[model samples]
Each structure stands twice: as C-alpha cells, then as structure tokens.
Target: MSETESKKPGYAEIASHFRKLIADGTLAPGDEMPSMRDVCEEFNVAITTANRAFRTLKEEGLTVVRPGRKTLVADQPRVAATASARLKRIARTGKPYAPNERSVDHTAQLRSMADPMLAQLLNVELHDEIVLRTRTFVRDGKRTVFAVSCIHMRAIIDVPELLSPEPFGQFWQEVYTARTGKVVTKSPERRGARLALDHELEALGVDVPAGTPVPVLVLVNTFSDEDGPIEVWEDVYAPGLWQVDTE
Candidate 1:
C-alpha cells in the first residue's frame, strides 16, 4: 500500500488518541482541551480533520462545550449525592422552615410570595431592607404546594403584634402600608420544565427509572414599594405534579 494509504484510519485514530489521554488521566475532568488549531498543528493535519476527531469525542460524552470559553473534559457518568434521593420527599412534605432548607412544598410558597416584581417597581427610603420567609404545605403525607413571603424589615417591625405567626394571615400590602405609610406592589411570573436533578424527583414523589426524565414548574417573584426593589424569590416544583405552559 502507498505511504498515505498505509496510514492508520483517520477519525478512529484521532478518537483513540483522545481516549487514551482520558483513560491515562492526562486529560482530567474539567481540564480545558487544546484548540482546533493547536490540535491540527500537533497532528500535522487540516483543521477540518482535527474538528472531526473532537466531534467524535464530544459525541461520546468525553467533553462539554462552555459558551464563551474553551471546551473541557466532562465528569464521566457524573457522581450523584445520596441527599438527592431524599430531596423530593423533604422538600414537598417537611414541616417548619429553616434557612436554605430544600423542600418542594416550601419552595412553592416562597415562589408565590415573591412572584410580584417588588424591587424594580417600589420607591423606598434608604434605611429599608427586605425580608423573605418561605414554607411548604402538605396534605395526607403528600406535598402539594410551595409558598414564599417577603416584606420590608422596616415596614413590618412596628407591629410586634404582626410578628406573630398569625399576622401572616393579614395581607402583605396592608402590613406594608401600616408600617411604611405606602402601598406595596407585586409582579409575578411562572414557568415550567423537566427536573434536571435526582433530588428533584425524590421531592416530587415521581419514579424516575435509571434514565427517565422528570418535569417541573418554576415561579419567579419580586416584591417592592413605590421606590425600588425589595426582594426576589424563586420556587421550583417537584416532578409529575406541574405542567409548564409555553408559547
């Protein structure tokens, strides 16, 4: 065979080279790969030829693309946390709220309270700060909804009476007006999609097979007064219970 014809296969050869690099730990996870030009120069090949090789690697889940950045090695088979398996149950059914706690039901409440865009629409004094409170609702051992609430710290501190858990029943706007002497404003938005994590499935009580995908709902909220933004809260729904409407 001619020297050119005798050379090893093209794309397969390139793929093998990269695979060795990965297997040998030379190209570790999160490591940025050389650019196409660099690979072409190193391999003494055309840019198109180098591109074909890289494409094969990407198709095999060996690398990922980061917009505005270089391609990098991906963590193969991605390791998941044990907590992920319990996130759905805890998020959807847990009682009492803790800071940074994850629960689907409570997250929904936070989502609802923060739905209104508050900061951009409200005008407020410089001394004011925003406060966010979130909780979850469960019925018969199943989580149903998530809720969130927010108000200005300065606006709510006056009524020590309102600080009690029962005060939450009073409308937030009324409480704001009573404290700040100004009306509160709200802006809300809703979105829905599939769950992207294992924890999401656990909280939603959905059975995700080894490879099954889950769906989710998202709510964005903003609270404000006549001056400017107060707080922003987001709630993500568990899988199987929400249908996201899209245009």
Candidate 2:
C-alpha cells in the first residue's frame, strides 16, 4: 500500500466533500473537478475510491464526466427534492407525468414473444408472451422522459387488449390484477451509466459529434406482488431529465 492509500476516505465522504463544494458555490457550474491524483492526495484515498465517489456524484446530477478525462460541475444542476416530488405524483397517478408537463404520449403494444435479452431479465424462458410499452413524456412539445416497459405473461393466462396509450398504467394495472389477483406492491429500480450507442443517442435526442461518447443512465426495475414477479422493465433517462435523491 502507498502512503495515501493507507488513509483513504470512504466513498460517501468523498462524495459529500464535493457536494459541499458544489452547494456552497465553491465549485461553480463548468468548474473542473479535482483530478484523480488531487482527490487521492486530498482525501488520502486510492484512485478506485475516488472514481467511485465521482460516479456517485455523476449519478446524483452533481457532476459531468467529459472527454479528455475531465470532470466538471453539471450545468442546470437538478434538485433531488423536485424529482422526488414528481416521482410521488407519478406513483399516485400511475402516469409518467413530470413537473411542467402538460400531457403524456404513450404507445404500447403486446408482442407475441419476449426477446432473449428480455427473457433473461425476466428470468423466464424465451419466446414467452409479453407486452412492450413505449412512452414519451412530453411537455410543450419537448420530450421529458422516453421510456420502455416489458411486461411478462408467463403467469397470466388471459389479458385484455392493452393497446391504448392514454390513461397511463391504469388499464395495464387492471389487467394485471384481474389476471393474477395480486396487487403490485413494489417496483424497485436500480440506476447505472454507460457510453451511449448510436441508436441510443438518436433515441435520447443527444447530439454528439464524431469521436465523442455521451454518458447516459441505464435503469432496471422489477414490478412484483406478494406471490411473485409481475413485470420487469428497463428505462433510460436522459441527462437533465431525472435525478437521484441525495438529500
């Protein structure tokens, strides 16, 4: 172990230190964050710890990791409180509505078979029946959140037409309850990030010139009830679209 590695700070502490800097205006928007070496020296931590701390900050919408190994404060820093409030509203209404959104445009259809990747995610055999719901939450003609959901039907023997895109998840929920007689009690989600692919960049409407990769979030959610899992979905939220509650 090196000298600095002997007294490395915990991941939480590193994230907290930077968050304080940003909140107090010491680290203004567009300000470059400290280099990995700087963080290692300042916190007496290893480079890996520093990297994790940086990842945490990025997930919380506090920082942006740019090209050339640069990290800077994010423009239009999101308020976690605001995101949480909107999340509560979405939960109650079963709609993908957000603040400042006048309406939502949903388009969903049932597929005869779940693809291999989705089958693995749902942990069921491949070629099983499923419904793929694609929705774009728009406000004033600007897309806020573009999302997709995969509903597995290994358990459900019968279901009504889930063709309509309006009314959010109301009809889907009704069909779910009617078929399984189980109320969906939980739908937990996990957040992660990676470089955007060509198709993904187009879908998210991100514009990046050649040789540049846009960072994006990848979230996985599991919808379940008392007996077993009901639906599994993976949603991607563009930068400046969503935030992780830190407060």
Candidate 3:
C-alpha cells in the first residue's frame, strides 16, 4: 500500500471517531449509522474491520443493532462536555460555557506556584510567577463547576488584559497569538475522579465535615503552541450536578 494509505486508521481509531461524533451530539440518539458495507467502502477497509469497529461501539453502549442489520446511536449514551467540547469552546469564545451558564470570577492574579504537582506539570520552578485565574460556574442557578487556569507568565507579558476578570470578546488564544506572535496549536487533557480538596469543596459549595473525602470529577488540560506549554487548566465538576461530552 502507499505510505498515506498504509497510515490510515484501523478499526479502533474509526470506532473512536464515531464515539466522538456521538459524544458531541453530531449523531444524536436513534440516528442511523452507515451500514457496515458502506463503512467498509468509505474507510477503505475490509468488511470484517468495519464489523469489528461497530462491535466495539456496541460493546461500549454507544450503538444498538437494529433488526435490518443497521446500527443506530444508543439512546442516552453517557456524555459530558469533556476536553474535546472544552477545546471547541476555547477556540470559539476563549472560555468553556454553554449559553445558559453564568460564572463568577473569584480570583485573577499573578501568583507563585504553591501546588508541587501543578508546578511540575507546568515545568516551572516552585517560586516562579504564574497567572492564576479562578472561577465558579452556575448552571440553572446551581453551582456546578469550578475551574482554574494557570498560565505561563511569558504569554501574558504584553497581553496584560488576560489577567482581567472578564470574558474575551473573541478567542483568547487568538488574542495571545496577535500579541505575542505565538500560536496555540495543541491542548492535551487528562481526567479522572478524585476526592475533592478542601478548597474545591468550598468552591462547589459542598458542605462536608472537615476532612471529608467527597468524590469529584477532575479534568486537567495543558494548552500548548510551537514553543512550549502556555497554560494548564484544572476543572472540577460536582458529582451528579454536571454532565460532559466525554472523550
């Protein structure tokens, strides 16, 4: 096979592609999927490969097999506005928020890195100054999410307004690129469930006794450009109060 053709994605990658489309609401519940034969033709793969990809989706509760050998997106596939959705929002509006959500900016300042893990993730020394931005999000009049963005100081040298407690009219990364000539090209993320820290508990208004271990969903993302990492975001979601487009 030609080099380009040889590098084509296999069944697993194809399954992931469909999973993303489902998670992002592109293929809504009950939407008919391409038949296995059509998938084979479209992806230039064998029918077995297409079947395997569909099987994977079915096993993952993302699809259902219909009587006519058709596949459909599963009803109520578990989803949340995860990293992919966040990246899309950042690209569009500089912040991740649905139109109905509201936010309260609690802190925005230049500060030293106190969290060792965060400092290490940012690849900065402990005492280095970083731009820290924190906010609480309210959806349907309920506090549901708390987010903190730690930005590299270098990116904010000329764009001081990044520290302002307000939303950018356009994508903030574009503003950064215009001001610093550094383009934001990559934003990789990791997520998991962890016990909420005391500050996080307070931010989400979870009233637990001291030292209570409240489970919370956490997502950490690093926004990078050609030079290196630009910012790291830690988002905390209250359990049972938030849903995300999981990636």
Judging by lDDT against the true structure, name the best candidate.
3
Clashes by residue pair, model 3: 79-244, 80-244, 80-245, 81-244, 81-245
Per-residue C-alpha lDDT of model 2 across residues 1-247, encoded as one tens digit per residue? 8865665679888887776556445677789999989998888777998999999999888899888768998865553223333344445455444333543445667675545655776666777667767765454355544566677655335554555556534446556677767787545456787676675566656778865867766666666667566676665566656554432
Error of 3 at 173 (Å): 2.3
- Computed on alpha carbons, the lDDT of every model, listed in order, comes to 0.51, 0.64, 0.75
Candidate 1 lDDT tens digits, 14-88: 766775555445677789989988887777677778889888777666678889988898764221111121232
RMSD of each: 18.9, 9.8, 5.0
* lDDT of candidate 3 at residue 143, scale 0 to 100: 76
Candidate 3 structure quality by residue, lDDT tens digits, 1-247: 7987897679988887786666545677788999887888788888888889889888777788878657898764433366457566555445455534567756889899987878877878887999999988775466777888888898777678878877666657778888778777655668778888898888888888999778988888887888778888888887664444433
**Is 2 or 3 the stronger prediction by TM-score?**
3
Candidate number with greatest TM-score: 3
The candidate 2 region of ten consecutive residues with least summed lDDT is 79-88
After superposing candidate 1 on the true structure, give the runs of residues whose Cα lies further than 4 Å from its correct spot. 1-130, 139-141, 150-153, 159-167, 192-215, 243-247
lDDT at 230, model 2: 64
lDDT-better candidate, 2 vs 3: 3
